[model samples]
Target chain A: MKKKFNLPVRQLATVGAFALFLLLGNFLMAKKIIGLYYTKVLMVAAINMILAVSLNIATGFLGQLPLGSAGFMAVGAYTSAIIMRKVTFVSPALAFPVCIIIGGLAAALCGFIIGLPALRLKGDYIAIITLGFAEIIRIVILNIDSALGITLTYGASNLKNIPKTTTFTNAFIWVFIVCYLVSALMKSRHGRAILSIRDNEIAAESCGINLTYYKTMAFIVYAFFTGIGGALYAGYLGILNPSGFSFAKSIDILVMVVLGGMGSMTGSVISAAVLTIVPEILHAFSDYRMIVYSLLLIVVMIFRPAGLMGNKEFSMDMLTGLFKKKAKGERSKK
Target chain B: MSTFSLIIKQIINGLQLGSIFALVAVGYSMVYGIIRLLNFAHCDIIMVGAYIAWFFMTNFANMPIIAVVASILGCTLLGVTIEKVAYKPLRSSPRISLLITAIGISYLLENTAQLVLGAAAKKVPGFFTAETIRIGQVTVSTASLVTIAVLAVSMVLLTLLVQKTKLGRAMRAVSEDAETAQLMGTNINGTISFTFAVGSALAGIGSVLYCCAYPQVSPTMGSMLGLKAFVAAVLGGIGSIPGAMIGGFMIGLTEVFVSAIGLSTWKDAVVFLILIIILLVKPSGILGKTVSEKV
Candidate 1:
């Protein structure tokens, strides 16, 4: 019988290295040498990571191509912002957690509503419905404030003046927490069910899996994180606009998921970081950036149809094995 | 205007708008029927067609008919080329891959048009001006009548092509089952290209009619119209040509009615609301047939 594997010393070093890099980034931002501009960019990247990974759960893991992530995010953003704006007496520290949870719940509720009918549909139909739902949500939000006679100031102009709560530290911490939580979830029993469904819903059902229950669970959970991500985004940007969460934004998030290996947590993180940073670096080609981005996606799909990472996970096995060999050699020398 | 006259005016407006949608929806429905891929680029094709017409009309103003003919032919050729280049190679790829490619093509076309044409909206020359006809207290613009007539002729021609021609038969055969049609000696590539050509040619006509009625053109104009036409196609039953025609009118009338009822802000929302409700109630769409897969 095979024994359980242990993490290698080298794999531990990589994680330690990444953690240190994040720490250094935070330190630099706090010290003011790197400038707040880059820090803001990093925050955007963190929010995008949260969105892309959460969406990967549904589209990549659950095998449902939901184009309504933007709609759900919009719901979460507006709900959290309204809560934060109305409950102004609460401490910012206390409100932060409340906002994230509220955002998540609002998004999950929207997801439940959208998913009830949408989960039953498949492929292009799901995509179209979700796309329509997002547009409807945008339009509804545009008219919502006016309908209530509240002067509906939050469409193209953006929702302003809630609180500036997100900092480099908070955003970095949230990024780590989200990445770890999503990765752990994906390694769990529920994660296995998601993968099974993605492989073949019919076969998975034949294996006695309740397709609707599990699929809805994934959908809800995905919506929850996406909502939190939206909250983080609203807080970081200090403004919320309907235009900010358009179909184009949804497409951008989808690009990250697609570019990252769809089912790979590591792939999501890397792609999110790269896609977020690459455009800023190519600022010289402002007009051509999207054109290049679109072409890159097309080329990548043509060359690597499975995506950049293709369901592979980060493993400590090889690193641990090498570390063990090195330890043995050192002991022999002693 | 009298209430009855107002109603007639609105109905005529709806018909004019619906016919444009029907033109674009036919391309969307045909492409979706054959490949099951919602060619997101189809919208941009309409934009390109409008731009082509604009370029010809602005530069070669002396020969207006030749310019119109050239724009339609240019757009048709462009559509066929896109199919040959981007779509055909990815035929066997996953739906998501093809979807991304369609989006890529869409962005490529839109951005290219923006770079070439500039971001500002352009004014297209009016095909007819200073002419109105009145009937029973209702006055209709000449352009509106022309739009209705052009759409009617386009529909009739499309119906004949789909129902009567040998190529149309081949298109139907391939759409039903590509491999089976190939086995039956149909040139799959040729049929698909022809489908794109016909669909794009119609888009060209739609663009001319749209520019005439609206009198404005922009690179991004096709995005909203394309999405609306897609909704219309789905409403009428995707893959059914007659269904697209009916769906187009329904969407146009609904939009007008929503705006007329003092819910101007909710016009876009109403269109989508209708789509969601339809999809929830009838997954195959209004006129679409459900095809069960044999395991």
Candidate 2:
């Protein structure tokens, strides 16, 4: 079966096809065949992909539920937004990466701090604590805006005039970087350790995998990318409101991850893209769109419990394994 | 107001708010205890109940008693349907899958309410006229008295139901061990559906009371309150009813006191602060017993 199918060649072809599709998309956007509005939607999809994939690392791969993605995203968004707003000397080119990094680092710091204590609490308890942390961060931001009187957050004022730095090129570039980085991480030894911990914390711990250290690391890394995604989101949308990063928004991201197969990076990417673009496509049904989305989620849970792609990767081995088992069954029948 | 009066006011307000939290928390704790699933839609049940009450108050202003009874029944039915449709099928699925479904059901309920009812906040007519009773230098509103009375009655009824009734015994048996209970001739589905119905009915009562005290109801109102109630449930111990009440009171008092200290905006932070502090000190919660997870 292994010799009958060349897995590497099929893998390369799949990558090439995706690359070509991305190039064509870039070309279409550049040539204005697709309007800027749609291009902007694609940009949002890229950001969502980053968030969904990063969060999937924690929620999907690690089997740990963390509901504080929005809180961490707000940290990244505000940190980046504040720096970009306040700093005058830096050029947008240098400022962009710096702000994104700072945003990610800030989120990572929060993640590490929260994760240290929270990693000890599993399942629903961890979920609630993380949710509390998110709410606290949001309320703190609101209070800071009110108390300082400096208009730091502009107090219900939409954070405006964020130098728009996220074009399709940059958005796609960052998306690719994040997707590849996380995918590779998931395939690495550290990824194995994270997955192991999710499978059984006790056994993982017994195997000398420090539950605290690895779990915290996965959380920080997840936060870092989510932060970067948030930074991009702030810049792309050109406005940041405290309400925009509410728990509902966090749930939206979670929906994307869950709708996409949890443990599958490709599933996250596809689900994020579909979820982001679908609402726009159903613009006429705006009021009922969310209702439909929610119902769709319920149906998915009831019927397709494994999600859209399950845990399978986009690989030839999976394809050939099907035929190989079929051939064996045929021989046995004969 | 004098300092002592102010202190008394805060305490009363805290108790009033805490009672509401306690009511909602019971729903959360009971559901969690029985199914080990955090019914995110439980909060929306509160919203649905409030809407039902609002429907009654608006269209049937002259029939308050009938309206309240109908609303409770409506919410009870909604809760039962939610369990049968949304949760039962996914019982054997992974915990996260159930969580996602709960969240989806929550969103579905909220959005459905928004679609059917407009996004604007609806006014729930005051159940009773404003009248304050004075005890020496301290005063409490008639509404506060009603809230306290309602909560007390509900608690007594719930305790009686859980302790004295055959259905309650069956519920307890199922919660302790579902498979074994089935062997003992208890209807697992009926008990769970009944539990959801009762829990949601309590949430409905809570919603009506909460709306009366606050006097405004919105479609999105349930999300925050729902989260707070979940926190209360956890703080008191996930499956313990009395613990939920205590947790709710603790949270309510903490919020009221924090606000009184001129940190009104930080009230949310304070709630979480208490949760974190409590969780760190007693990971099992204030009134919760530790259950060992099988390896």
Candidate 3:
């Protein structure tokens, strides 16, 4: 009778709310109700959200453990930063997006190269190989200038003078785009192929999914957006150095992905926000914070290994279902 | 020094480093073989061992024998306790959880050590006396000689223990199939605990040797060393004992050579590059078995 108050309208409503929230956040910043400190935290949370979600595609969906998110991020950051520095004629507005894309592409190229050979190995080996690659990437960035006799990358020293272009509005926008693409990817036929591979590699291969192709594809997508996140990270900080993208940095991102439920985009968003802010809130226990945080990780895995959200996503329907108690019936869909 | 002599010295240097890597890597390989975990805490155990040694050496003022025994025993106990407390419950869970838990434990050890010991490195002088034995064209430190000798003795003892003992057989059975081993009345828990003990003991020995070479103990020292040793484990073929040893030597020599060529800064990169290349060429590692997944 009411034309079935359907999917498209619900999608439109969610989209509108998302935009409205963004506008509210910007307005609050403008009004100084969200201070500079809080705004910085929000920006960092946005960056980490991009990192965790993009990492989930490769780690969560592809079921591969790669310790090289920071490597790709470093590549993207340096690539875009260097290019931005090189191009003097263009306006900041025009050059920023192009550089971000180029940075992403460069990182994707690295992922493809590393993943092609690395995906051949099984679980722990892939993790080790990726860690090696990340370390090598950092060292290369650290020494590329002095070894090759070029002024690029500036070696171990920090690369400075890049314009800061990552505003809160733009970074959160990128986060939404990355989350959308990743989720859409999971729902696509190809995403099915990727997930199936993760669920059981041999079964998928027997069913005729080219194991290498799908694996590398997911990894490339991961590296590409991680690169973009890194690019934004680059613009956010306006400086770059190999020291900034160490193995520990990659571990930090992994901690976020693992702390949030792997394979859950909404979980990544929540954990990223919570993790970024809570550390600041507990600033008094800065030294002991890692100890507590690590203990929390152990407890979470022991009691609930599925992480804070498990594999469940935070859907709009779930929110409505909480109010109406019909989400389960709706989710069954039969 | 002549070119030949310099090369000889570098070879000695490589072997010294290689011996330490092999010592550390044995722990990683053994743990991975039995438990199928990366055991990020294995490296941190070595760090704890170093600190214990530092504690003994600094507080007791030069009781090297007491320091060595206490450090090794401390690492062994810590390793077994970590397995009991942190990893036992997750034995049946997904491997990723175990891995994250291991990492969490590693962070716990490091941060605790940092908070307690302070982040700055406490320099502990070399355990070996500064005795240089010069042969026809080469001069060798007694520490290097002792390192290689200890590695050799440990490897022999380990191989013997794994090959000729009941516990070793139980370890092999559990690694092959835990359910089958338990069905056959193997004490799976005891065997796993024993494995952790042995591995941590190796880490303890490694830390002692490392303290000799580097003469310093810091909270973060073990992270990179542990990573390199794990790579060594992978390079030789994960889950293979001799593979770990060979991988360690290769990595050790690679680092020495890279540094020798005036690319000291790039040595870490070179070690990782060698690992990547080796894995690309031989996916299972030099001595690793190629396991095919059964559908």
Candidate 4:
């Protein structure tokens, strides 16, 4: 008898691919093959991937249309930025991780509070409330200092000069970890329950799934990672403005999810990369970029509502299936 | 101004703003009632309407009435076309897809405006003379009077159209149940197009009023305005016409009062905070029907 390698192929591939990506990134950076502009694009794509994947939990898995991903990001960005700014005694490496946690927790708390009352409503109502919440968040950030007599948030003006802690390596690592955790969570029993709710709410309820509990849980998870992405974004920019996290920003992330396939994590990653990079490559169309992007959204939604992937997960089985078909073809030729 | 006059003036201001919001909210609630869409682009239609009015008044005809009518007609055509093109194809798709399309359409309109007219805010030429009418210590601008008058007339005419006419019945039937309405020989497509036209017309009227008061038009103006009007629709209980009117008024009042209390910067926040509280306390809204999902 021969012993065989039976370790999870998907997990192994993910680790291998991520390691390879990091190595390639380092090589490119070291050799100056990757310029500042390209590196910035890659980092932004990583942040968007994190956003799209986390939003998939709520919009894709849980079947909720929350148009407030940017609000959570804003909370994370501001909280983490404030922490990094105020906590000058800590090392950048130590402070960076702590700020991510703090920012994520703050956004999670906001999600819990918002979802408590909001998730009760059905359909478009939730979208409206979430949008309003995002705007309200912006407005509060704009006027909070004046209202509270505190100098925090700086009141609508851009909060500038924070440490730049988000390197390509760490961003890639964070995105990898988030994607791994999200995929794992989606594979668990809890993920199935959430998927059931998305498929059929009444039937899901009859099966004894706690609708409110699961809904809020998914939302909080979505907010938590959105916050982390925002924290990463803040560090990447070293300055923050509430305007950057406007309703348009939320729509930007939503477009990626919708274009990628709401329920497919791999779809989100692909679309996020394509959408982010395509715009940069076509710099001449910068003015028409939004127009074209929006036109694509309407066309895609009209033609392929399930998105480019249509709820299909990318798996190692796909690769093996292709190989097996090729092998059979070779055998027939022989 | 004395505190009493100042308070009175703010009330007038609130009413003027509320009427415009109510007009926009009416379109929002009507479209939602018929198609079950939030119609994110509805407010952008208002932006288009404003620009059309600006173009007509500045370039074609300087007459305010011509500008107003042209704007309304332009929006009606644009709204109907958008429905036919972007939304109609996705009619059978999931609600989320339609919502995303609406957002896309909104982005398209905003970007087009940005590309064509530039992102800088354009000062809209005054459509009416600024005349002040005094009632005791409180003075009200003619714009406020005209806005209230327009809102009143539109509301009455809309109520009559919705309650008494054959097309209105068809609209009601489609909104209630499209399949059943189609089964009963209602022109579902026509009614939907009509709904869009009426809603867009109202948005056009709202835009004129908004420009009268604010006097500035920009590509991004519709977003905040649309969001607030949607809040008004939600607050009034979506799918209910009269509810939208009350919701709009409440939002306007809240915004004005917030500013009156020297929290002008927080006015937008206050409006949203009120919406959240209303949702938490009564998610169905002040005038919206409580929908019971059948298990």
Candidate 5:
């Protein structure tokens, strides 16, 4: 009877934490503590957080360096933006979330197509191929409207007047949901298998873990969120340009993941926020910002290649251990 | 011009473009061969070379040959410095880290250029006198002919340097197994630095040729050019010398043909598409050995 009453402790705790977060978020927004400028900044930060965490799934966990997250994002952004524009019957609020999901699916499809052939190769080949895919995506988007004789993406001129359905609250909710889902996936049996593959591909194969299936799965999931982030980005900006989703954008996301610690979800989230905010804070130093970013990347890789968090994750165990140690110290002093 | 003359002109243009790509691609291939790094910054050596040449031409002398030599020396120094300062410490780290550091170095070079020189594109002074040669039916640009001549001469010189020189043997040994090379009393650092120097010198000459053809220099100019050259390197099987040259010409020809077919806007896409197809269909690339990894 006691064992039955024990319940799923972790799940219960997660739900409670989520509820608390919503309450706190509501209070902050209601009180206007996070001003308009901060809200906009936070929204961008949240989108980056989603991108970084999702990219972590591939580069951090699966140990594959995919340089095409922006390509997937562009696909999603265009898909969602077009859907929102064309589907006049549906309400903007309802259509927005649905469009984001559809956009994610579109990106996932692209990921499946690109990943099949790309993941077959190892190391830098995957990087270059993925990079090629990204450039192709950007170029196609840039030239597709001209070729097709339609204003789908408006070509290089870009799409203007996208319905602004993405708000701070909605973006925040999505970021939390994505972070939760990714972390949950990372903790599952499938996550362990993925980690094993990263640790040693040959060993993982010998142990009967299917490489192709898992690699594609990771790529697909990563692409899905990248697409969602893109859809949200489109709504936030109220415009879309192929140039906005270039190889530079992909590198920016990569920098976040690399800075945060590839294997740590929390690290990615924190780094994403910091990186996004740092530029805005240092707006006066705009020209030097890229120089600083480049120097930081080189310095970090040289000194601490593992990144800020390394492979260690934040958990209740760490907190409890700290509290227990403090209590024991006090007790001993007494 | 007649259609046959037009075709000849396009082929000349392709050869000129191809020569630049081959020079840059050789640098990319050599670096990748030795360090197993993509060296994302390798292409920026061209930009650095171009700027150096431009400075020499505008501020000092309009002497093309001296500018070319000075730019080549400048790029060699920059490449060696980057290898020593940024990449050397992360040599034993993960390949991804090295790759990211290379990207960092690339960004650093580009941003520095943007800051110092401004972001606008500057016109490069013509290296050679504007002259045209007429055949029986077709006219050819002297610049294109000179580019091809320079490419041929450089290829011959580079081949001899790699095949016959003691330093070339050290580079080959380091590429094969650095640990073994070190055991055999090779100065590994010197060998790697030499490789960077030679590769960057080629990029320097490539910059001079590219500037002669296009006559424009910008902070971000190296990016697209570098990407194309890197694609050429990969298409030719990444680690092979002759493969890079062949791949460079193939890319150049493909781009010219694509534009000739009136898909000028899609030329970049087509180049990237070719890279994807080549990677998928033949990962080892043409002229490359299919060496499978063993546990």
Candidate 6:
């Protein structure tokens, strides 16, 4: 009875903390204590964190490399942007959330269709097939305007004039939800089956986990979040170009997942923030920075193959442990 | 121009493009057969080879032959060095790690090239004489004929090398089972290096041909070309030589035909669509063996 009473208190406190962070951040931006430029960077970082975390579900937990994430993002982005364009009758507050949902659903549907045939192949073949699918999507989007003889996407010209409804507060709320749902899922029985599949596919199959169902579930979930992230990106930018979603962009998100410990959500968030911020700060050494970044990736893989956190999440215990003399022991061992 | 001549001209263009793709795809197939790596950096080797050839030919201006040889040698050396430095220590690690390392290397090369050479596309002077061979309305360049001829020679030589050589036996044995091959006294490191050497050399040849056909060298030229060649390799059943050649030609023709029929913008889309269809129908590809996994 005491533990049950504590649970609600703890949940209320967490909600209070989230609310505090959101309001504080907004106040700082309003007063210009935090510049608009930095605010934009923070929002971009939040979106990237969402992308990295979503991709981790498949690449880290499910153990598949589908390189068409940018394509799914494109689907979500264009869908949401187009829907928002059509629904000028509704209030911005009412229409924004609905558009994001529709965008995510569209991408989720795409993920299901593509996942069926693409997942039949294993490892490198799956990677290549997904890449093919991404390329096809990009090309279709690029040529669709001319093919249809209409201005649906505006094709290479870029879709513009969508209202910028994704603020920092709203974006972080979505990020919080995505992170929470992923953690909750991974803690459930279904998440155990997904983890089992990643650990050993053949063994998981023998154990009566329907391989296709779980694999598709991971993919669908991944697609939905990616779409939500993309929807935010479209709203933030106020423009949507097919060129924005490319193979290189997919690799950029993958780099974040790799730089972080793939199986760890906190690692994805921290690395995503650092990567987004650092690049913006080092705008002068742009070309040389990429050289350094690639070298970092290589050296990191060689020296610490599992990544910075090595599949471990950061927790309060970790911080408290550092204060204790027992900190000499690797906390990862637990 | 009549319709028949335009079609014939397009066929010739396809053949020339296809031959270059075949050379690169063979390289991809050979390396993948042994290491099971996509070898993402292989494409950058082609770009480097083009740059090296451009450097030599521009400085020397008289001996195009020396430029070709240097490009090939540079590619081979670079390929071997990358394998030794980046890949060697990770042999026992997970495949995903190896894959990530490959991606890092690819980015490294492309970025370094961009930093050093700048991102502007360089126009390569015609290595061959600007002479055209024409019969009726189909006019083909001398370079196109040379590319086709070189492809035929390379295929025959490569087929003979893989089928009849001692190194070939070692390669076959290793790809089949590395531990067994080592137990049977094959030098695993040497065999892998040799595979990289030959594959990079093919990429070098492809670079020279690509420069001839496209007549431009840029830092990112290899990526698009490499991606297509990789697609061809997969379409042909990755590890098979004949399959790579056939897949390259098929891809080249399909691209040409798609564009020729007035869907020029949809060429890339059509190519990927075909790959998806074929992969779905036959997961192992047209000529790939469907090896059942053993628990």
* Candidate 5 lDDT tens digits, A92-169: 898999999999999999999899888888778778778888889999999988898987889878798889999877
Each prediction's DockQ? 0.65, 0.70, 0.77, 0.78, 0.82, 0.69
Error of 3 at B194 (Å): 0.6
Between prediction 1 and prediction 6, which has the larger lDDT? 6
Tell me the tens digit of each residue's lDDT in model 4 across A104-174: 99999999999888887777777877888888888888878888899899866889888899999998899
Ten contiguous residues minimizing lDDT sum, candidate 1 chain A: A1-10
Give the alpha carbon lDDT tens digit for every residue of B102-213 in model 2. 8899999999999889899999877775568888898888777788789889999998999899999988998888999999999999999989988989998898878777
If both were scored by lDDT, which would come out higher, candidate 2 or candidate 3?
3
* Tens digit of per-residue lDDT, candidate 2, span A220-283: 9999999999899888877888888888778888888878888888898999999999888978
Clashing pairs in 6: none
lDDT of 1 at A164: 71
Model 6 lDDT on a 0 to 1 scale:
0.87
Which CAPRI tier for candidate 5? high
Candidate 1 CAPRI classification by DockQ? medium
**Steric clash pairs (candidate 1):** A8-A320, A159-A240
lDDT by residue for model 4 (B3-35), tens: 888888988899999999999999999999999
Candidate 2 lDDT score relative to the true structure: 0.86
What's the TM for model 2?
0.93
Superposition TM-score, candidate 3 onto the true structure: 0.96
**Residue B75 deviation, candidate 5, in Å?**
0.5
lDDT of 1 at B260: 80
Q: Comparing 3 and 5 by DockQ, which wins?
A: 5
Best by DockQ: 5
Instruction: Point out where model 2 deviates above 4 Å.
Output: A3-23, A149-151, A206-208, A316-334
Model 1, position A334: C-alpha lDDT score: 100
**TM-score, cand. 1 vs. native:** 0.93
